[model samples]
Target chain A: MSSRPGVATRARPSAVPVAPARGRRRKRSYVRLVLLLPAFVSLAFVTIYPLGFTVYASLTDWNLFNFGAPVRFVGFRNWIELWRDQNFLIAFKNTAVFVLIATPLTYLVGLMVAVALDTATVGKRFFRVLFWLPLMLSSVLVTVVIGRMMFDPFVGPVDSVLDRLGVPQVLWLANPRTAMMTIIILQVWWGTAYTIMLLVAALESLPPELNEAARVDGAGEWRAFWEITFPLLLPVSSAVFLIQIVDAWKVFDIINVLTGGGPGTATQSISLLVFQQGVQGGNISYASAMAWMLTVTIAVVAGTVYWLSRRWTD
Target chain B: MRRSKGAWFFTYGVLTAWSLLLLFPMYWVVTTSFKTRPAISGGATFVPWVDFDPSLQAWRELFSESTDRWLPFFANSLIISVVTAALASVFGMMGGYALARWRRLGPFASAQFGFLLLGQRMFPAALLALPMLIMFQDLKLLDTRVGLILLYTAFSTPFAVWLLTEFIRSVPVEIEESAMLDGSSRLGVIFRITLPLVLPGLIGVFVLVLAGAWNEYFFALVLTFSESVTVPIFLANQINQTESVGWYFVSAIGILSSFPLIIAALVLQRFIQRGLVAGAVK
Candidate 1:
């Protein structure tokens, strides 16, 4: 994970000399501020300002339907309604299930593929490119191609091959349980590419001496991997896990295109529901409340994982 | 480190199986685009001529007949992605350079400022969708490509700044300091010395931002309506109208829109890996 030693080591504060004159130091600081101005201005306008606006909007009874009507401060009414709403509860459960399942699944599968690629002697580059190909694709494309086309019930290859093999048809996206499964499968499919890329790089960077020493000490391949390689990989593995957890919580594009949260909201994610209420349903205040809830949930979950991983690593 | 023949066999076998599973959807998309409606609805056909008759019907429909529906969206995506990438790279480079060379900016240290920028990404885009819609509505910037370009630039700049900072930090300060000592202005040192050294990192930032904007769906779905619909939004809209539109056509559009990124990813695999690792591991 460290950069090339000497190159990245040069930027420490102690490496640069202190400015001799106070006036010149002040002027230099101003120049540095000028350099950061564009990024600060743009991010403030889009991210920071909108964040504040969402907080304020969540407290008010603002509906796009009531055009020109004066907005009223509802004072926790929307937050109160969120817990009582069944749709919101279902979406929350779905998102929780998604993050819980998809994060670990992606990490494990990515590790397996990364190990496979690292162990293989032939066609390593070809397989790397093939496995990394899905990460290049947009989620919408992945859903349309894989979720819709490949998993289509009647004419899909899965069903066709199943029929040929004399097995009953499994509803990939129609039945409730199977619908969630399909979304998870799609997520894992698209997500593991990132995990593989990171882990492969991590694996390649590990010194061969540890595994070689283990092998010489009469360890089998699996034993060597478990005792030597896997422990060494924990840092990168934790990083990948945290990233996947955050991404899995924001699951939207696939569900939107694949099921549209159909099968009776069985696969509705938090973001999808927020979009449904805030944008499509025009209950901006309520949706904003739900969005803030999602934000808080993500922060808590990510913070917990980060804390746990740090403890485990230490 | 030597492996037994059986171990090598197992490794190759596992990799081969996983590769096929990964390749099947891509294969299906490419073949499905060539299939006709009857050919598609009849059953899964793997071959071109034997299982089904290959045709240009989907391609013709997309490119020739429904040109108005997809082309404008395609153009919008191109303009928005390129402009966003360019703006983000420039802003990110400047921000990154400031963080790299300077120790402080007013009350905050450079590292704290960088972390503040990265914190912007933690909030979900869904959280911003409603407020941005209303904000854009008030500003009369709704449903415009320019609005999307600015928003995407903001969304992409944090990672770009973080990544490019690492890249810029790797450039030894002595080079720039020596250039300044040689009577070159600070701006001249940056342009003539620092810029050339960090050019690869700059391109990495540009490509990453371009791909991120190109693949973005939620913001485009929320911010734009008709004229500024990007490629992913257009494809999603097609999915909504599935009754009239065929999967063949959608598959074609998927292949066409995603082809560029796939090629770029393969071509710039090294730079992309560096950028990704820098973002994740650091």
Candidate 2:
């Protein structure tokens, strides 16, 4: 019941009569620290400790094959080797391409669907639920259902329909270019649901009066959307865009399940390579270096997007 | 605002087309679950009665004695996901409440703490997978349900903490203060007053975390092999191990594994939507 705004005064009205204010504040501070300790401890043990270990491992020559060989500090040899490694280089390029193409494409499709949902007068609730369904699905299920079943080049429905239309069957997951396209398509299909969810929420939260005013001023629907609604949505849209970029950068499960990063490493994301080098091939130090590289890349990309978004939104 | 007939037509057209495109896979998976191997391998059949006759051969095969291990995997997923969600939710609630009520803890402000928790999400799981594998090996916790439960809980708690902090902040502080004035302890006030008020948010956190853990694949694949395989790992193994196993069986297992969460999502749609947007929009 403190009168000051935004400040939490721990001066308990009942306790203030008996205990000294300073002592009460100290006790309350202890309580707060105790409450916060579990979360911090768990996160540190799981995230911070592992991150530190990864950093250490990345600098050393640690391999499971050389068991009990006594790990030695290599002074950035692993990092340098990663630079020259063709597989790692390919993975870096593929991950970058996947993020660049998928992020913007997801935003565009999400925006289109969000606009459609927002403007529709009939069955709004039904459509919202239907579109949001994909977001509820796991990546494995999406890959199986969408990638393997529906897009099966041999007997899948997509090829069947194309055949009926007299169009030659397209190799969805066999060819390198088409394989990448299939991955992107699966990403857009699954990722757009989340984008739609965020965008729809943003669109609905917008003040209707601005668009109403624009319409009354004889601006067409598209103009009103672009001039009034779109600007207003910049903040949320930019946030969603940044999130999609970070998420796309972490793309692993779909690729692992759908094509196993196949078509000869054409769809190999950094995560896939990290798994291959570290877990499968027992090259711990090299994979740790790659993992750290992926981490730094995501951090930089996220920071850039956040900085650019602030400028645009402001 | 009113629109012309043409505009309405265009809007509905887009909606209809997108809906079909979005729903086709789901429809295909469901129908494929009902078809025989011949129907699936011969060609794509859009309808059951029109193009091919439907059978429960795949469904029967999934539950039959030959595939006896499917139940254990399903149970493992269920147990691991539920335990992780519950653990994360409880820990996150306590942490979130501490963050909401206090301005600072030691040298860091509550907002900074919240941001630190959220920053955990940005670290790629692949970065942590190797260390966790080595750590779990040392602890002799590899390929066990307890190992997965621990990892999933730690990974999910940050999200829960961030989202629940927002939910906790929405609750007015006056209610708790009044209860404390009436000779109730802080813990009592939290349990009796705040917990009930934030029930919806709690449920939202639980459902979201549960679904995530249920669907988790990367960590499970890295950590588990035989005794503690989850549905995703099992499904992937089924596909990768043999080319002879029919697509219909894979589809049946996929449908079986995915249905529980889909139903939960539909039932708790309102809370889930609110939870989803709470972090993103603000």
Candidate 3:
């Protein structure tokens, strides 16, 4: 735990400095920049350069495999064709639906679990670790498990359970109608742990006396939460919500492993489709175009959420 | 105050049920690892425990030349994660301490750190796969463990630095100054004084880095082809290969791959949580 300054002298103060210290700091900022140049360079390569390269790639016919042959520069043909592609359209639609359905559901469940655990008089610590267990397991493992148990046509556990209940033993994942839904369900399971951790942290940070006073005022549990707890929670929830929105944009591994965008591209996420084109199918330029478009769409969608949340919070 | 005992039972029952649901996949993994191929391949009955007795056959298959892909794959992951953890932590601490007290909480510095934090978390990680591979190859770091480590360090360090930096700032400055005034150099002050104080923060950063490296598939998929494959790649291949999908082998690797981190998390839950909340407003 951090060393705190208690009630007295409580505000986190900055380093006080003499004139010499101020001059030294101004000097040091530039010095730190020079010193930290390598880290900055590394970050640029990781974050920025790839962006530039991909953007350039999207505009041209640059296939490395055809190294012997000269590279051709196709204009915005790739982007135009990508927009026209039916599969790409399905992909965009699928990702939007998945995000729309998954986020609120995960938020509700994740918040309930986090808040309940945080306020619990017993097993709070134990439950925190228990809840986070899913997060520790790699998505690769989770996807494999999902691919077997949920997406499998026959002997999938979902169908097995449904069969016993006398419901139709429909293969929800294999069928186009239910494939996206199944993926969405799996996605929720994968992400709930993170939401639980963050929400629990925020809930725990709520001043205890607020709840105590709310109870004293004859406020029921639900009323107190709505009136006091929820309002207090909105900021952190805003942050978490923005983070999840960004996360939804980039999710690739689970979809790649689980469905492979099968059953006539019913469940192909934008990322999955992009990967399929660029890597597997070897349509590098077209894939780059798709990726560029998807990235822009994500930026617009998630960026709006981020901006709205920031505005709401401020 | 007497509520229904039945309702209390029901609440706990539901909680326990949910907890069991959370744990069953993991448990199923462990159990399936012990089942025979026949039992696993799903013939008459799917009960791993009931049909066939325990066997190390799957493990043998995993280690043998036929499935020897995993041997190198696991080793690659181990190297990458361990190296990433070590470098990211050391560099992170240095960077963190600098950020914490280097200059005043000037707007630009704070903005820089904030932007770093947001940018790292926000941008889709997998999108960098193609471009990063090209960059790494151009730099001759492609398909090299060192290349992957550098890339991993690039991504993981920002979060580590931010969190650790926040933790560093939270430390009473007088502690470092006191040590420094006593003929302790800046490095000495950091090593002898600052590090011990931020041990919990360091632990959290390491755990996070390890988790990132372990779970990272995109880079491991793209940057690494032959020699530098990780567990995720290995697992994916196992899934792809039609040579009898051994659930237990996958599960065993899954359990084995994640067990070290999970155990570390359990033991250091207090330390990690404490470190994680280091930057929360007082």
Candidate 4:
């Protein structure tokens, strides 16, 4: 019986031991490279190649209709001219203010809603549905829906209600002061759902026992939230903030549909400016140059956010 | 633990307020869509609530009021969304399967995929104008539904692959191994064993990809010409129409256009939430 067992084990070992020999190993490696090659090349030709082409085009005065006509290498002039361009300057300012307002506001609203949803005893599912619904909406559609009513000046319901209730009807998307303000409103409206998702995800992952411990310590509801729930929500809050900052930097459909950078170009964002220059005015190279600049800036900001997330989480 | 007094009120108050604001845009679009031409532009009282002197004035215009081929374009949008979702899920499933099973090549490929995905759509839509225009023109695909689908798939595939890859990776290899032991082929194991488990993820990614396809405008606008216009292009066409088809019909179109996406969002919101949490955590 012992001899039979040894023979059986040896037979199995001999069959299995040298199946994937050195030649098979090489072929397998080659196959893996083949499988992964498309993803890498797609990233290259589709993604990286365009980026490189845009950079080269920026250095030349490449007109829209004449990609073949751009032989003149007009060096830093596009960059310099865009720097002095008043529209670009205004767009940059508006973009900065937008990032400042929307990022924190989104995080705040998201955290508040997430906290509220977590603490709710009834209709939890419904609340989650309502809260997460907006994040799924297309920006173009949302902007189109709200543009007219929300921006209505005279006899607009907002004005009518405010007048009846003893408040001024501020021209929301029209007035330059409140143009940015209204943009912030649109942002917070859309961004809150994203924030809520992350915050809720984080809150759920957290140990409920910590919140319970705080409650047992006789911490008031607000104090328990401030001490326990709030701190843990920070990582998620930062993540949402980073995403909004990157996204808001590219704010387009809202600015396009709502204002058309109207009332003397008050609400022009970086992206809207690029669209106008590239498409409307046919200043292709300048727009591409400016766009490349904006892209690098955003990449840096996004990189910082990622580094911070890793710094804390790790 | 002692539950605090008035907490429910606070929660309810906050939730209700946010919901109203969230719902405000949808309400505004719906109400505005019902208004008459002059009522929309003649005065600032644009809310369609009282103006429910309800007319099919706008809807009629959207469907047949154009010699410029309206119905065909709407059909184009529908076809594109459906095709993009279907193809993206199928190919994305294959790609994701390969990725999930091959993670031993690199864990970083698996670990920080979210960050890579974050930058995936970073390229501005207009930036693709020159290159895609060149490529599609060469392939004789310019102004074709096939061209747009190709572009949509290109834009959305990275995210779909990343999401589905994670979903697939979470499926234990032992399941496949057991099926293989039972004399199943690789294709059979995938169809009979792997797909059923990740079905929710597949649907979730489909919804996400389809929603993105429906929303894309810049590329669709640039890549497509006369015969291939989507709803967004149809709406953008009205931009140059001076006198008649004022913002009222625009609002109507806006509401109508949003209907499919909103319903999709509402219906799949729950499944997507589950998919995200499960795929993300695992």
Candidate 5:
């Protein structure tokens, strides 16, 4: 991704009385650094400082119970213990399953809707606004509305229809089997909007002549899509895939509002686990260890997605 | 490339169904806000006039109760979002223009730096939960509006830099340089020329950053308790007492929480389109 540095080593005579190139470049570099200084400094306080603090705290035994007590250096104890803990394990599994399931599902639905909108010339702007409605709302707000009003067993329209159809009542939030499923549904509903918009943009950017030429060559609509449009969309698809995976990985609010990681911690995520340990449980150092583990997990997951997409593209 | 009538029909049919499904929950929220208790629990009603008598009891309770914390939380959210948006815009406009034009860090270094900012966006706020609590406690910033404002600014600035850098990049560099040559200071060029050209983009970034802070859940959840709790936290705490609070009030606050962003997003949809497409590039 690098090119040769554009440093021009033009020769100049002393008679011309010109400034030295090195001095000029150095002055420009100083100005650039000054321009960049503020953002870097603020980011250091927010991102770099917090990251360093988190890593350091992970190595100590800093529980809330011992607030006024002297902090003890406990190397790798919190990490090792959390790895073996059942709650952490459950949270890990749930978060992994969520990213795996949600990202691909969002892409599939998003692509279909994007293509449909492309073909349907009528009311494109109207449909775009409708798809974007969910993205405008906060995840917490969306979760609460869906959980209480739309999915409530007794009063929710969903269960109400089921009751009218002679089916018995089923608790969506209480049962372990259905808890995560409900969250996934709400997630797909709330999230697919951005993906759809991105894909629509990608689809619209494609030159019409290419698809038309394919059609002229006797390719059907599906054939044209598979052979022509789909290949061109790979870059956009990879971006959307990686973005959705990251979005779904940090699944806290939806689960919190919908289930509160309940039915005996059935849907507890890494974020929720950290919240419970650090904020609710007041085990600061222990939660920091969990948070560090989560950070590594996210990096690995994101890296693998990027790597896999690169391989496919290659 | 041409479709049969049947195919066109199928496309419209599927889209109409999708649009309806997409709009239903929003409709349900609004209609439920206007319904009485009996009407709410009775069943799903598509028409408010036909099935249920409308009422303002929930809205009234939301605004008037002294013990209720909805209005204060709402105010906290607005203050935090506005201040964060303004501060992030300033930092991003300055830094983003430098990155766009100067190439100060050289090509590879600039790319790496940009990626670093982006990777920060993907960070889990939970990582800061325990640390921020202790840090704010030491600094006496815990549960204060200033604490949330600063935290949100830190959280939002990277995104502002990333997005606004792209926005500035889209404006041709020759324009700024020519202005600079005409007796204008560097900052003068940015203000008099570049900023006006990118004003729409700035508004887009402002609304986008504001939306991010507004929708932020984990920070509001963990960082603040009583003194500076945001609307999301307030509504979430209300959910914990669902036995007493009822669904009507929840619906009302849910509407209150998201209405501003929805309106902004609608008005700035074009800027959003440009930002999203441009944002996906390397």
Candidate 6:
């Protein structure tokens, strides 16, 4: 034991060692790089390469069917065609309508629910889970269960209630007018839970001082909420706003399952249009152009939300 | 805070109604699943077990020989989700630790790299669908479990990276440095100390990613067809088929498909709450 020399100094108990030799240090860094490489490389291949390919593919007339044919570059033609394409225009309009309707409605309902839950003194956790259950369920299942079983004009519970109430049996999904409304209702019911949970989290995370200060100033609950609490919540609200807009813009699975972009293109969002064109109709490049257009629109909306939120905070 | 009894009643009433409204579909699916076909179609009873005699016919049909495909679809969903979550957790943990510990890149560089990684999730999956499909076609990965696992891992890794990085950053660096001073290698320190510290976060990420991939519809719809169809695809097909198929069966399948995620959401509610706020508001 006494002959075990230099074991203590060799330990060199310090926070971090001043690394030994430049070449060994370089080799250690190479190890670090090797560890990091798998993630970034796969990310690049899966995301970056595909994104670059999409940008390039958008400029060409690449049909899904003609795999063996030479691809032709038709710069800006797909974009130009999108401006005049009736279905694309409808899809764009529907997508905008969905974002506009869904975002605000979800925000208001979510805020209300959040406020309500916050005010309640008991069983908050239970209600939180209850509200979030819809969001947890897959969109595909939500759409299917709601579409086929609950809203079906023939066997649906809603229609059954209508029949009981002596109201007419309206074709909720079959009519062009109600189809979009049905989609919106389904979306709101499915989506509001997430917004509520988000807003609830935001509400819970709020510092108690502001509201307490407002109360000390003799402000009413409503007044304090509007003047102090709401301002503090602007960041979360804007985040939820932007996220909901992006999500509503990307509405595909629900519409695909619920209405299949019909009663004759009534609920056709840009995502559904992309699917129809790219996968179903084989107009790959056209759909790519549409997808890029949708992407730019989402980016712009999110960016604007960030800018506006910053200015508001300022 | 000093509201009167009437105000309390009103609050509770409104919340109860809203909660019911939000949860009605789930309730409807459960109730409908237990109903007889006539009750499903004719009366649409709210209390299936009480108002009418409940039947397990739909449940039986779901597992019967004719619809034996349901079992395989459920298994595929399980396999895909678990594999994707497991793989994403490993890759994300390693990458996240490297990003956290690699001081050669300054703090700003790390932030930039983090954002660069996360920005991959910002773009819609639709934009990349065509290119990805064509690539999959070339690689002969379409309709394969490995293909979906790879795609989901790629897509979900960014989330895992961001989340795990947050977890790793929260871990005190002093612990790691002390471990390093004890002559432990970086890998050893990570395996011995960092991973255990962040195990809860890892479990959170696993559950979150599991729910995500399990609930995913778009890629599963686009990528796989017959041999590798997931639960979502199976349920979608069942619901989208003709209305002649009774609502009980549709509801039963819907309940079955959503059951796992619902459990996850309830069990992992705190993680989800934190994740939602972290991913966006933070």
Q: Please give the lDDT score at residue B170 for candidate 5.
A: 88
Give the alpha carbon lDDT tens digit for every residue of B1-282 in model 3: 222465355445545655776776666676667766666555322455565677887677666744565667778888899899888888777667667775644456654764565364555654666677567777998678888888898887776777787778889898877877788887788788888888988988888788789888876876778878788887777777776576667767776777887898788777776654453322
lDDT of each residue in B1-282, candidate 5, tens digit only: 458787688678878878978888888889888877888766676677787888998888877874255778888899999999999888888778877885538655665677778777677778866778888889999899999888888777777787888778889988887877788987888888899998877887788778888888888887788888898888777778736447787888888888888888888888866766666655
Evaluate model 2 with DockQ and give the value.
0.75
Residue lDDT tens for model 5, A1-314: 01112333335555543455656767777877777777787678677888888888889988777758998898989989997899999999999988888888889988888888888887988988788778778888888888766888877888877888998987898899788888988888888888888888889989999988987888888788888999888989999988888778788889888788988978999999899888998888888898888888888888998898889888
What proportion of the true contacts does each candidate reproduce?
0.75, 0.72, 0.30, 0.24, 0.66, 0.68
**Model 3 TM-score (B-chain only):** 0.87
TM-scores computed on chain B for all candidates: 0.95, 0.96, 0.87, 0.83, 0.92, 0.92
Preferred candidate (TM-score higher): 3 or 4: 3
DockQ of 3: 0.42
- lDDT string, candidate 2, A180-246, tens digits: 9989999999999989999899888887788789888999888888988888889988889878988
Per-residue accuracy of model 6 over A210-298 as CA lDDT, tens digit each: 77787878987777888888887888888888888888888888888888988888888898888878977788888999999999999
Model 2 residue B187 lDDT score: 89
Clashing pairs in 6: none
Task: List ranges where model 2 is wrong by over 4 Å.
Answer: A1-23
lDDT for each of the candidates? Answer: 0.87, 0.87, 0.72, 0.72, 0.82, 0.81
For candidate 2, the chain B TM-score comes to 0.96
- How much is A69 displaced in model 2, in angstroms? 1.2
What lDDT tens digits, residue by residue, belong to model 3 across residues A1-314? Answer: 12223422334243432444445556767756653554566567677788887888888887767767776788998989877789889888888877888888778778877766765556756777898877666888788766564345553455656667898867775688787777777778888877877778888777788988888888776687788999888887876776677678676887777767777788778888766767666567777888778677777876787678778767
How well does candidate 5 score on lDDT at residue A95? 91
- Assign candidate 5 its CAPRI class: medium
Worst 10 residues of 2 chain A by lDDT: A1-10
DockQ of each: 0.73, 0.75, 0.42, 0.40, 0.64, 0.65
Which of candidates 3 and 6 reaches a greater lDDT?
A: 6
Ranking by DockQ: 2, 1, 6, 5, 3, 4
